[model samples]
Target: MTSLDMTREALARAERESAMKSRILATVSHDIRTPLSGIAGMSHLLGQTRLTPEQANYLAGIGQSVQALSQLVDDLLDFSAIEAGRFKLHPRDDDLRQLIESVVEILAHRAHEKGIEIASWVAADVPGLLSFDPERLRQVLFNLVGNAVKFTNEGGVLVSASMVEGELEIRVRDTGPGMSVRGQERLFREFEQVGEEKSRIGGTGLGLAISRRIVLEAGGSIAVESELGVGSTFVVRVPVGQPSDFRLRQARATMLSSTHMLIIAPDGVCREALAAAVTSLGGTVRLAATPADLLASLEHAADAFTDIVVDRRLADFLSEELCKHPVFRNPATRRILLIDPETRSTTRFLGAGYDSWLVRPLRERSLVGVLQGRMKGIELRDPINDNRSNSRWTQAEGSGLDVLLAEDDPVNRLLLKTVLKKGGHRVSEVETLRDLIAAATQATGRPGAIVTDLSMPGGNGLDALSAIRDFERTNRLAEVPIIVVTGSAGSETRKAAIDAGATELFVKPADPAKLAELLASYAARRAG
Candidate 1:
């Protein structure tokens, strides 16, 4: 055979092999990721269970390892998809403000843990709604922000967006060791790392390459500006336009429309508490304790229900069944899964099907925000009661009382429990709402007060609080004080807790001394 023919044959063979490799990697990565996600999630859930300090640390390490594995698999798949031109933009109207804020909130904790500050600013003039695929935008932003936080040591990261010539220009800037000229050239090239030295950071090195492809596919361009030993700024520019639904929604804003919500769970306490919370926000909530109950509820008001929230486990069983149902056929209705943050397995399970997942420990504000974000037509009533504001109580300590507490966040929950227990009062602790309810109800003596986190697995603290109140009302015991502990403080949440018979609402990271004083006052009142 001629040399020219042999060279052509070799080139064709190489192209075919490359294509086959991409497909193999894609399939293997996808399959591996499904199980790996479950492993990572389960590890997280295991960490939340009762463990010794050492055991807890070990579980945390396992969780981190699984997360790293998941990221590696995801990067491999993303790179393969980009190379094959399978990565495409899926654009939809998105709330830019909400999208950016959510990303920042999700990443801020990790950045802070690394001693890096992450901040975001959105120009007020930015449209409330813009045409973009939020998922792709989020993925690109995640890559940029992740790299910034990973490389930075002592300095901070800033994310901000502004309008420029009918386009939105988003920037992620980091105070980290800058890249060299060669590094910049290889940054957006496939499978290229900054340095061959083992001392540098680790990654699949395809993130920036994939990010560039995603940005370009979305009708935008991405560029980087960096200085060695100074920092780096990655910018993305995408065209901005008012969303079609935004205009129609604005026109209909004057008309009062009632939104129907469905809460699917086996526990009555969680069902009732969520119902009350939704009701407080001017939404009518339908509680369904079982799949049969949910189907029945949907039958009665198939067209009326606008949103659905189900526990992750229950959602797993119902999603396929529910999707086949006539009620869920409507594309307008939103489906959300209420998930246990510690139960990473549940997260992976829910991720397979649900529109979104609401992490357990649902504060009133977050719940309201989620609902509002989903049901754009429903106007939320302000939950805060400014008319009854008490400046004196702002700094006043909580009433002193022997309390039974149920919470999942170890640091915050333990800190609060310690402060209350040290204040010459008895304090019993449990991790889940189910345990809290069982212990509180089965106790030989009544607790002077019950303190609980609003979100917990099995059920939320709000559920426990409602159950306690219902038991007291049914048994005719003297009204026991209850305090709702939450991470977010909003008037709406406070009102909902009070309406559900809670005595007070306490935000996390609250002053220990002030909480102790409040507990003392409440204890004195009960004694009196």
Candidate 2:
């Protein structure tokens, strides 16, 4: 054969192999998930039953196992999809802290079982809101943390993130067991668990391989460090654009001008992190390791501190010991508690007597928010509320109702319908443009919102959107938010949808929580 002919044959063989792998993975995914779903469903139902503590624990373990199996299947399919050139990234603006928190929470149970502590923090300079593929970023975090939890038996796992030279550097460090210099060579390669880790920690061994692919695809790099018994740290560095790429709620410039902060944290590293954040916010910081030290610092200070920041661990460990301390009781001091975002809630901390609290892996904007509010002696809110668009709806008012769903794909329609139903929304499903028009034009019992899929029969989704807008205008009706979800979101298609009046456009596999949040916001606005 000629050189060109040989190259063509090689390419053909590779294609054939990829197709076969994809088909096998697809079949296994369906077969495995069908049984796993039933197991998860029954286990969920069993969990709601009144049972002894031991039995409840057993049920919880079963649920975790099922979820682990499901995750493995998903990983396999994702790998196959990527190899087949089907994996796509849908970037959107989201809070990085919230994304990390969501992943940490999902894997916390496993860590807790091993008597491990998992804590995460972002550098102060890192923007709280940035544009990225949340789902992909989340998968990367989940794999790293899950591996950390799986291997670590003692000490703790830390998810630390920082922005360095235009890249977001994330490190997942664990104190469980480390690897050797020679063994690190095969870590990121496909199906290679390296050394004895494959036996010690049971996994399909595809997690790191998939994570590297995702990180690289997103214009990032991932690396690792390990010593035989010293545990390991995996570092992933991804370009997250410059600070201007973020939606800045508060200026990066120090807002803490002339403000004084006293940080009391049990972890020395945490103390330094807090101090650095305060310094960036244009404030001076004093560190305290104990309540006694705090009192001495307060007495010796040239001026009273504008804020007293305490780690929730330090405050609660000492119980009322700190609350009764003269420094804590001082009228001039505004108390702020630093907490792990995964395990801590604002209500819990607030009830424990902090005026306000900041989630850890502290962001500069969040630090400024807490300090700024306290400078004025106002009640402080979580950092998440600071950057997220504040929805007017309180929990009671945010309840969704009577949503009109337009989609031709039965599977997607049913899946979304069940999700909405479980979230307390009454869904009216329509497969055709006529049904959608009829539903929208109903004389009474209006839907709270309309969700439509593009490329449906009988009409273009953009046209349907325009018709809906025109109907609302002609009939003197209240504006109902329209959500467009489609597989194709070319610039022209997006512009067309927006011109016709779409509130938001989501590509396939949109986050359900986001969809619900949007719907709730519309409901609350209309009610207001």
Which candidate achieves the best lDDT against the true structure?
2
**Candidate maximizing TM-score:** 2
Error of 2 at 18 (Å): 1.5
Write down the RMSD of all candidates, one decimal each.
24.6, 7.1
lDDT of 2 by residue, 63-118 (tens): 66876776777678778888888777778778887787567655655665666666
Model 2 segments more than 4 A misplaced: 1-7, 30-56, 85-98, 105-115, 127-132, 194-200, 243-250, 257-259, 268-276, 290-303, 316-325, 337-368, 374-528
- Ten contiguous residues minimizing lDDT sum, candidate 2: 381-390
- Candidate 1's displacement at residue 44, Å, is 2.8
Per-residue lDDT over 43-134 for candidate 1, one digit per residue giving the tens place of the 0 to 100 score: 53343346776776676567556656666666776676666655666677788767776676566556656755555655434666788888
Distance from true location, Cα of 26 in model 1, Å = 2.8
Model 1, runs deviating above 4 Å = 1-19, 195-201, 244-528
What are the lDDT scores of the predictions, listed in order? 0.66, 0.71
* TM-score of each model, in listed order: 0.45, 0.67
User: Measured by TM-score, how close is model 1 to the native structure?
Assistant: 0.45
